[model samples]
Target chain A: MEYLLHIAILVSIYAMLGLSLDLIVGYAGLLSITHAAFYGIGAYGTALLMINQGFGFFTAMLLGMVISGVVALVIGAVLSRFRGDYYALGSFGFNVIIFSILLNWQSLTRGPLGIPGIHRPELFGISFSDNVMFLILCIILGAIVYGVCWYLTRSSFGRVLTAIREDENMVQVFGYATPYFKLVVFVIAAMLAALAGALLASYITFIDPSSFSLNESIFILAIIILGGLASHEGALAGAFFLIVLPEALRFLGFPSDVAAQMRQVTYGAILVLFMLYRPQGFLGKFRMN
Target chain B: MDILVQILLNAVIAGAIYTLIALGFTLMYSTAKFFDLGYGALIAVGGYATYWSYKQIDLPVWLAIGIGVATAGLLAFLVERFIYRKLRERKASGTILLIASLGVLTIIQAVIAIIFSSQFQTLSKNIGSTRTFNIAGGVITDVQALIFISGLVIMTGVGIVLSRTLFGKAVRAVADDSTVASIVGINSPRILGIVAAVGGAIGGLSGIAVGFDTGIEPLMGMSLLLKGVIAAIIGGIGSIYGAVLGAFLLALIENLGAWQFAGEWKDAIAFAVLIAFLLFRPKGILSK
Candidate 1:
């Protein structure tokens, strides 16, 4: 039961990531590989605040969102100038830069040693210290993220985003500032990814640079890809499936040493197979042109 | 003065490797119109193939290197034929191709890790006894000299071929406009396949150079590929000359930045240069 709870919590955390990434990559038509950079920003920001400044979880998380939003605005402005492969490459550069900061800025992030003993969120007479309580908090936060995404995708803004995805020139001809739209969606997605990072930091009670590398960004991307791009529910389902996959592999009785590599191979195969076979994914409405 | 010379020499050596990588990368991008991240994987495949033949199978060093480069070229040719060709036939978006390449990268890196156990091993066994030469108070190893010579030779050879040969003209046509090239009787698909093979071979050579200079590991390609990509961007994405120029400039800046700050910040410096180029000069220094 406890094991199941742990996995559920992980799924919820990653689901937030999947949903957030879906907004930019799916709805906004921007293929970003820098989600983990924002995720790392949130994790590090929140961790430092809690560990050093003695700020509560909520305060740190909100501040983390603001910081990520500001950074995203800058990065998004630059990335908006690029299209297709350049956009992805530019975003990838950001992820690597941020990761380098996390790994090298020893005075701030403690470098590779990582921050430990992070306290879970505590509310009005409600401590989320217990696993079950934490699970509830994760679900509630996950649902709110889902709801926000749902509203955005269904709104006029979302329609514009989708239109921009399909044909940015046409959307611009229709008199919408496509760059602003792209920038705004990119910022929102970064903030949500930060939220997930904050939740993860508080829940795991530890955070490190290794957890937020380019590989993590790719993993987040794999989640949305597997879940089906542009679909919030697909993100959720994808997160659930991926988070549980390692455990499923564990049960298969493979050598522990090779299990991780096998998982990577599976992810790689998924990306290739999906692109070749099901570009729209299971529940995605959008397909790459 | 001596320290400065050594740093300059180091930058040049590093530039040699980046030149190879960036050259191959730009070549493929010119033809394929997408970032084939799988090209990064071919680096490791080359190094490991050489390692397996030289160490495991006890082949001669030259034979091993040949096998390594050939293996990478074959694998790249196959990938182009089996995977990228299908996508191109369907007119898949560059974004989709990029994601698929990411998948290819992940799969190759993992497979290498699973097979090689992610250990850092050197290609050259005679590390201590290897011959070295001093130029202007800076030292150069035999392998490093070879890397530099190979880069220059390959660059000149590729330039000549592209400018002088019929096949190169076909490649240039395909790069300029595959649709028009196809209409003009140029087999764009075959040209792309050849480009992939050639690019993969160059990338393999760089990996082998690195393996000899430092060591080999599965994850080594990512950082190297990033630097190559940055160099390619700096020089002008589709221009071979620009790729070479960019590689040397990038290496110099990286070494200088490392000298100014710390060695670990080398990757950050390269990326900062990339972001700057993307913003100020997205088309790069030389665009043909």
Candidate 2:
């Protein structure tokens, strides 16, 4: 039961990540691979505030989201000039830069030793120290994030984002100010990613730079691709499937030493196969260009 | 003055490594027009192939180098023939190709880790036995000199091939316009295959040099590839001379920055320079 609840909490956190990424990659058609950076920012923000400043989880999380959003605003503005492959590369560069900061800024980050003893959130005189209580908190937060994503994608702004993805020049010709749409969506996605990060930090009670490396970013990308692009349901499905698939692989009983490498190999093979055979994905409404 | 000379020598050696990588990367990108992330995997393939040949199979160092280079080229050729060629036939978008390459990269890197155990492997048998030359106030190892020489030779060789040979002409034609090249009786696929093989060979050689310089690890490929890609972009993607120029410029800036601050800031400095160029001068120094 504990194991099951643990997986549930993780799935909820990653679902938020997937949904946030879907807004940028799916709705806005911007292949931003820096989601992990924002996720790390949120996690570190919450962890530092709670551990150092004695702030509550809710306050830290809100501040984390704001911090991520503000950084995303600056990054998004700079990234607005790039298109297609350049945009991906630019985002890739930013992820690397952020990771370097996380790793090298030892004065703040403690540099790879990682921050530990992160507290579970306490809300309204109630402690979420128990796994079940924490799971509930995660579910509520996950649902809020999902609802926001769903509502955003269903709005007129969402239509403009989709149009920009399909044809940015056409969207601009239609007077939508495509860069503004892209920037707004990018910032929102980053904030949601931060929220997920905060949940993860609290649940794990530890945070590290390794968790937000480029590999993690790519793993999140794989989730969106496998789940189906531009569909909220696809993001949810993708999160559940990816989170469960690895656990299912664990039961296959490969040698402990080789099992982890085998999982990675499987992930790589699956990604290549998906791109080759089903670029549109299982539940995606749109195919990545 | 001694510190300055040392820094300059370091910069040149670093530039040579980056030039080798960027040259191959630029070659592949010019023809394929996609970020082939799998190219990063080939760096590890080269390093590990040499390790296996030298240590496991007990081959001579020269023979190991030969096998390593061949393995990288062969693997690259196979990937182009099997995966990328099929996608090209389908006219898949560049983004799809990039993602597919990323997948291929992941698979190769994981397989490598599974086989090699993710531990760092040194190429040189005796690190202290290698001879070093003192130039003015700076010291240069034999391997570093070899890298510089090899970088110059390969650049000149590629320059000649691209400008003076029929194969080079065919490659340039395909890169400029594959459809038109095919219409004019050039086998674009075959040209692209040759280009891939050549690029892989160059990348493989650089990998081996890097291994001898600072040892090899399974995850080293990504960092090398990023630096190469940045250099290629900054030098102007398709221009061969531009890539070389970019490599040196990047090395100079990186080494100089390292001199001023902590060494860990090197990667950050590189990326900062890359971002600055991307935002301010997307066409790079030598736009094609």
Candidate 3:
């Protein structure tokens, strides 16, 4: 039961990332692979504040969001002019470059040794020392994020993003600056991803460059892809399902050595199969193709 | 002058390996309209296959390289037909395809690590380990010469196949529009199978050659892939000749950067170039 809740917490964290990514990749039709960089920013933000400046969790979390937003804004401004694969590569460069910083900037990040011993969030004479308690906090954050996404996706502004996805040239002709809409969506998504990162850092109580590599970004986006791209609920469901599936694969009595490899191969095959057979996801409103 | 010649030779060898990676990368992107980020893993796969064949079975040099290339081809065929081809049938988005490639990459790299222990392994045969000749006051290894010759052969062969053959036209047809190509009776699935297998084979050869030129490890593919991507981007994403030109340019700049600054600053320089290119010319040198 405890493990289940822990998985639920992970699902929420990834859902946080997946939903934000869906906004840019699904709604805005702008594929950015640098979401993990923003996620790293949040983790680093919280970690640096608590460790270095002796800041509290809530204040650090807020600052994490702000710092992530500003970074995303700068990257987005530059990359928004590009489209599709170009945009993806540009964002990818940002992700790799940031990862290099995390790996090589030994003084600040402690390099490959990683940042350990991050204290749990404390507030109002209470400490979030238990996994269950942390789970509760993450769920609440997840709900708030869901609410914001729900509002944005249903708003007129949200409709503009969807339209931009379908045909940005038309959106441009309609007098809505396409790049401007993309920038707005991208920034919001980056902020949400950073929030997830903060919650994740607090949960793990350890942070490393390994967690923010292109691999993690791809995994988060996989959750969105598997869950369906456009809807918040779909993203959530995808995260929960994929996370649980690997665990499910664990119980099948497979050998330990091959199990890990098979899990990934199976995971890749499943993703490809889903993309090939169910382009719309389980509950997506529109087909990905 | 000797130092300049040595650097130039090193750049060419590095450029040759980068070109192979870039070629494989460009082939998939141009045809599939997706980034198979997993191609890097295939490089690792090739290197390891060659390693095992040479180290464990004690296979001869030529046979070991052949086995490695064949293994890559097999892996590619199985993956595409079972994985990516299915995704195409469903008309999956580029992002979905991209994510799937990541899963493959993670799986493949992990498998290599599990088998090889993530340690850098030297090739059993040192084709150019000791053989060297001087050219205009600069020393050049036979392996460096081999890399140049093989790279030119592959590039020219690929160019000719793409431009002058019926098979090439079929590939172009399918690449342009699979549905329309199928309507023209091009058997796109078959063509896709061939190209994907070809890409894998090239990647594997690339891996072995690179392993001989440098060394082999599990994680090397990521940085190499990044360089290949940089080459593809600066040269234009989908063009073959563009990829060739881009590879040389990237290696030249990177070597120059490493020479000018510290080796640590070399990666940073390449990244800066990519950023500048993205900012000024999103379409790249070849501009689709």
Candidate 4:
């Protein structure tokens, strides 16, 4: 039961990641792979603030969102200048840069040593210290993230983002400032990613730079790609599938040494197969062009 | 003066490695018109293949190198014939191809790790017995000097072929416009397959050299790929000469930055240069 609860928490955290990345990649048509950096920023921001400033969980989360948003604004500005393949490359570069900072800035982050004993959230004197309680908190937060994405996709702003994805020049010709729309969605997505990061930091009770490297970013990307682009339900399904599939493999009695590589092989094969046969993904309305 | 010469020498050595990588990368990119991230994995393929042949099978070094390079080239050719050719037939976009290539990279790297157990391995029989050459108060190992000479030779050979040979012209035609090249009776797909094989061979050579110089690890391809990509972009993506120039410039900047700051800052500095180039000069230094 405890193991099940741990998996649930992880699923929820990754579900949030998939939903947020979908907004940028699926809706906005920007193949941005920098989600993990924002996720890291949120984790590091909340962790540092809570541990050093004695801020409450909610307060730290809010500040982390702000920090992520500001950083996203700067990054989005630069990323806006690029389209398609360069956009992906530029975003990839940012992910590496942020990861380098996280790994090297040993003073604040403790670098490889990582930050430990992160506090769980407290609301109105109710502590989410236990696994079940933390699961509840995660579900609630995950639902909020899902709700936000749903609302955005239904709005006119969301339509513009979709339009930009389909045809940015056509949308611009229709009097929409495409760059601003892209920037706005990118920022929003970064903040949402940050929220997931905060929850992860609190839930894991430890945070490290290694957790947010380019590989993590790629994993988040694979989640969305597997789920279905531009489909919120797809993101959730993807999160569940990717997170659970590896765990299921663990029960197959493979040697521990080859288990991790086997998991990677599975993911790599899936990505290739999907691109070849099912680029639209399981639930995605938008096919990755 | 000695320190300066040492830094310069280090830059040249690094430049040689980056040049080989960029050359292969640019050659493929010019034809495929997508970042074949799987090309990066071929580096490790070469290194590990060579290691297996030399250490495990106890083959001669020359034979091992031949097998290593051939394996990478043959693998790349097969990948083109089987996967990328199909994707191109479907008219998949560059982004899709890039992601598909990423998948290939992941699979290849993971497979290598699983087979090799992810432990760092050295190709050289006697690691400490390497002869060192002192040039202008700077030291370079025999392998590093070989790396430089090989890079130069490959660069010259490739430059001559592209400029002087009919096959090179066909590749240039395909790069400029694949439809037109096909219409003009050139076999674009065949050209692309050959290019992939040649590029993979060059990448394999660099990997084997790196294995000899430092060591071989499964994950070593990624950073090298990034540096090569940066070099290609900095020099002008499709221009062969530009890749050489960009590689040297990148190596110089990286070494100088490492000299001024901590060695750990090398990647950051290299990436900073990449970002700067991407922002200010997207077409690169050579493109008009």
Compare the candidates by lDDT and give the number of the best one: 4
- Over B112-210, each residue of candidate 2 has an lDDT whose tens digit, in order, gives 888998889898887899999999999999999999999999999999999999989999999999999999999999988989998998898889989
Candidate 4, residues B196-270, lDDT tens digits: the string is 999999999889989998999987887788889999999988999999999999999999999998777788899
- For model 1, which pairs clash? none
Higher DockQ: candidate 1 or 4?
A: 1
Identify the runs in model 4 with alpha carbons over 4 angstroms from their true place: A52-54
- Model 2 CAPRI quality: medium
TM-score of chain B of 2: 0.99
Candidate 2 wrong stretches, greater than 4 Å:
none
Model 1 docking category: medium
- Tens digit per residue, CA lDDT, model 1, A208-286: 9978877788888888888888998899988988889877788898788789888888888888888998898888878
Task: Tell me which of candidates 2 and 3 scores higher on TM-score.
Answer: 2
Residues A143-206 of candidate 4 have per-residue lDDT tens digits of 9999999999999999989999999899889998788888999999999999999999999989
Task: TM-score each candidate.
Answer: 0.95, 0.97, 0.89, 0.96
lDDT of 1 by residue, B1-288 (tens): 998898999999999999999998988999999988888899999999999999888999999999999998888899899999998777788989999998888899899989989889999978799899999999999999999999999999999999999999999999999999999888888899999999999899889999999999997887788899999999989999999999999999999999989988898899889989988998889966
The lowest-lDDT stretch of 10 consecutive residues in candidate 3 chain B is B121-130
lDDT of each: 0.91, 0.89, 0.82, 0.92
Each model's Cα RMSD: 1.9, 1.5, 3.2, 1.8
Error of 3 at A181 (Å): 1.7
> Pairing residues by index, what is the TM-score of model 1?
0.95
